[model samples]
Target: MTKKFYTVSARYWSTLDSVEIVQDGEKSAKFNASVITAPAEYSFHCQLVGTDDLYPAKLIPNDDEAEKWDVLISSFQIQGFNIENNQFSYASDCTSFFTPGIWMGLVTSIILLWILTYGIHMIMQLTTNSRFDDPKGPALSVPQTE
Candidate 1:
């Protein structure tokens, strides 16, 4: 009987989110999240890539080594917020509140304020026009009859 061995290679990449790896196998590795923060006006995504193959032989043999080789891949997305030492740590979901929500709220408030001011101005203008006469226009005159 011949002893067979296999090798595995894994890589993970993310734009704004974090990744946590959990393995219950003989070979395992740990990785850190990317440093890029989420965008203020849009949502972002994360990606993972993993590859595995049999060792020694460049191509996997169908004879017996194929049956011995096994690959397991697992991934998880972490969410929520944490604050420590006066520093803030935000996950993908948590960061969204600061980015999209804040800007949306700001824009909505500004639009509402403009609409309210315009409505008030229109009302005041109507009242003034009804109460006062135009000073620059000619007055009404009647011809005197003999």
Candidate 2:
């Protein structure tokens, strides 16, 4: 079957606030007892651009009550095809502490810090305040002192 070409896009907005969900209702409290967090809100738009089936795109809705926010896809592509549509075929529910960029940045920072530290250390070690005297040759006598 010839795949249909569709375009879909979504924009997300989020804020950090202290909110907690109690048995009665949500209240102002530290999220996970860690820090204040804000709620997330997003909207989606679907449209058809042209006839191309390079890849099929699927957008899944989040079903989590705690994080009452829609799944926002920053960018997705398949077979070099940009996916933008509301074709539900897959779902993912997970939280991540670090992405590839985050990890790369962290590693790069550490490397830079190390390079700076090593450079400073080398400079400090190489510095000399006084010159070494000739030990092999006879020492010169002072005019007044012995």
Candidate 3:
């Protein structure tokens, strides 16, 4: 099998004091403020698959390659709160149900329903016999044919 390469680049405005790479619940590599300031890049290879219908695909590190992606921040503290997770949050790329096409369809259906209702009302009005109408003269009776 061929190897797949993935690149991740991030730029943050927050002051990063230090970064730590933890493996097996222990710190494997630690970089201080000076190292974090320098321009650098890190690459890792992992398996990714479709998460669900909503989500497309995501990186899944196996047991043998999990450690390569386990980079934890040692000094990532904000107001005495520790934010050490290094994984990016998953975001779905799927289209929602209420899209433009669906909206157009809904609007069309509403218009058609309104037109149908109006047509029915007009037909009823046209076919209805008004009891308030005055008779022009005496009613004429048809001659019986035996």
lDDT of each: 0.39, 0.36, 0.38
lDDT of 1 by residue, 1-146 (tens): 11122233132222423233335654333322344333332222223222233211112223342334443323323222232555334333322346677899999999999999999999887733223445797764544561
Full-model lDDT, candidate 3: 0.38
Candidate 3 C-alpha lDDT tens digits along 14-85: 222543446689635443332122111222112222212232222233234343453322222121122236
Candidate 3 regions off by >4 Å? 1-93, 127-146
Mark the regions of model 2 whose C-alpha exceeds 4 Å error after superposition.
1-93, 129-146
Winner on lDDT (2 vs 3): 3
- Please list the Cα RMSD from the true structure of every candidate, rounded to 1 decimal place: 15.9, 16.2, 13.9
* 24 Cα displacement, candidate 2 (Å): 38
Backbone clash tally for model 2? 7
- The digit string of per-residue lDDT tens for model 2 on 36-134 reads 111122222223211132212222222245344322223321111223475432322122358689999999999999999999999988866344557
- TM-score for all predictions? 0.29, 0.27, 0.27
Q: lDDT, candidate 3, residue 120?
A: 95
Instruction: Please list the residue runs of candidate 1 whose C-alpha ends up more than 4 Å from where it truly belongs after superposition.
Output: 1-25, 34-102, 127-146
